[model samples]
Target: MPSLPKPRLRRPARGRGSAVAHAPEPETPNVEVVEHDGLRWVNIVQPRQVDRAWLEEHFAFHPLDYEDVFSRNQRPKVDEYEDYLFVVLHFPAFDKQVGRLNAAEVDVFVGPDFVITLPNQPIQPLEYLFTQAQQRDDVRASLFGKGAGYLLYKIVDDCVDASFPMLRKIGNKLERLEEDIFEGRSGEIVRDLSNAKQEIINFRKIVRPQRSALADLERTKRYIPDDLDIYFDDINDASERIWDMLENFKEVVEGLESTNESVLSHQLNDVLRVLTAFSAVMLPLTFVASIFGMNVHVPGQDSITAFWIVIAFMVGLLGGMFYLFRRRGWL
Candidate 1:
């Protein structure tokens, strides 16, 4: 088979300092679709490079949207331009072996006749959509013509669905960590909990803003078809649920940290108590030895029998101190 063409790199139309300009170095794949047969069936593949000038000549995408396409680390949001809808969505993937979350950035431009998607990395949702578009005859039939809105809705919906598995994995990991914390596995468990909490926080940061953006999209009266409003509402609901899940997870993590600290503090107090008891028992014994070791002629130092008497006296004195401390509940 012939090799596919290399993807083009396209610079934003605006200057480098522009708020929505594309990154100078393109690290994501650009996917574009051409509608045909009153159905929209477009092959989804990552272009090796994107040519902004070429896109300008061929597609009528707004300059700002194009800049968004090339921009690195664009915040999740929705911007409706005069002729197109621009949106950024986040899809998170958890790598079990690595114990981390990988968040992919997907940027989209929906025009009257075409749809363009740019991703910071290859994401599973787009791959699944592309594969289904090719292999499923029903999908192929509806995707091109009357079902463009439906197709867009399905893509966003699928992305939201994909997040659930990652969330569940995180939830499970947290549960295990909670068990470990309770079981007295302090050191490693605490570190892992910290890392997991950070990942969840970062994920929430990406998700919450997107939730607000979706809410705004739902409220606006615009070119979006009436039938598609429900789909957007579904997306809004899913985003809200994810937000809530993250918040709950954060609270659980905080509780785990606090519990871990309390356990550690208790252990430290136990150790200190043992040390203090030992020191108390030895204090009188040290005093007895110091008096006998005096260089001047002392009452107990003159005879051989005096050493035995001193040893007996030291033992009795240590015994008395132990009894007193025990009576005071200090031992």
Candidate 2:
């Protein structure tokens, strides 16, 4: 294979007194090239903002793939062309205000000699991978030295690994919610659990289809190298693990919701029990007072001691009812 061309460097000044040579023009800021061992990787971030004419002029990619580029909300899939493979993968992107994960789309065009990447959202893992590839020759060699197939593997692997941190954050949030529920601080826990459950569902929506896409890539022909098949398998395994974790999270959130309902029901039942006991004790006293308040002449109506006698009789009746309730274990 022929060696790759070196970057154009400006000639240095001939002598100390000579004027400094003009610096070479910089490449487009949005476009980055990583080259090693005759392999080339071109990564374009946020291609929507870049001029469409530039993409049309540069690469002889399939018309359908280019059309897919302009299209929005494409499902996770891999389409094989004669000369390259077009892959659309969605990764989890968290929304802080909504407290949920959203799908972030990444389009990858993998050809025999080169790979092109365009991402719709700011993917931190991809950014870090590019930075490392730029700064470290070892990283560049390990990634760019291989064919486009292996480079795609690296990108998908990084994307899959990115979810682990977010999963940890959600796991911690769940633990805190469980603690709050048990401590009688469950007022806001219902809302928090609902958000968590929705987040888990969002993760599932992104991960399950992504896992299928990776599985398809593993079986894809022509563009994918034979030896690199195992690497894609590893990526598929990671995606499957993510899906399983999401399922577990959904179950936990459901359990939390059930526990919250039980706790609330028990609390309400206790309140109703206390109210019933108060009403039962007050019923007879109310009846006795009504009798005394009547206009009809009854026994001991003329004696001043009648009022005291009735009061003592009501107090004794209240004590007897309390004793009966205690004996029945209703209080």
Candidate 2: lDDT of 244?
80
> Considering every candidate listed, which one attains the maximal lDDT?
2
lDDT of 1 by residue, 3-66 (tens): 2247566654766666884446634435344445544433333333445554565556677777
Q: What is the C-alpha RMSD of each candidate to the true structure, in Å?
A: 8.8, 6.1
Q: How many residue pairs clash in model 2? A: 0
Query: For each candidate, what is the lDDT?
Result: 0.72, 0.82
Model 2, position 139, has a per-residue lDDT of 93
Off-target runs (Cα >4 Å) in candidate 2 are 1-29
Error of 1 at 2 (Å): 25
Give all TM-scores, in the order shown. Answer: 0.80, 0.88
* Candidate with best TM-score: 2
lDDT of 2 by residue, 1-331 (tens): 2233344666654886788777876444466778778677777777753434556656677777877777887898999887778899999998777756888888988878878788876799998998899899989888876677778888888988999999989889889999999999776678888888888888888887777788898899666778988888888887787788888888998999899889988888889988998899999999999998899998888988998999999999999999998899878
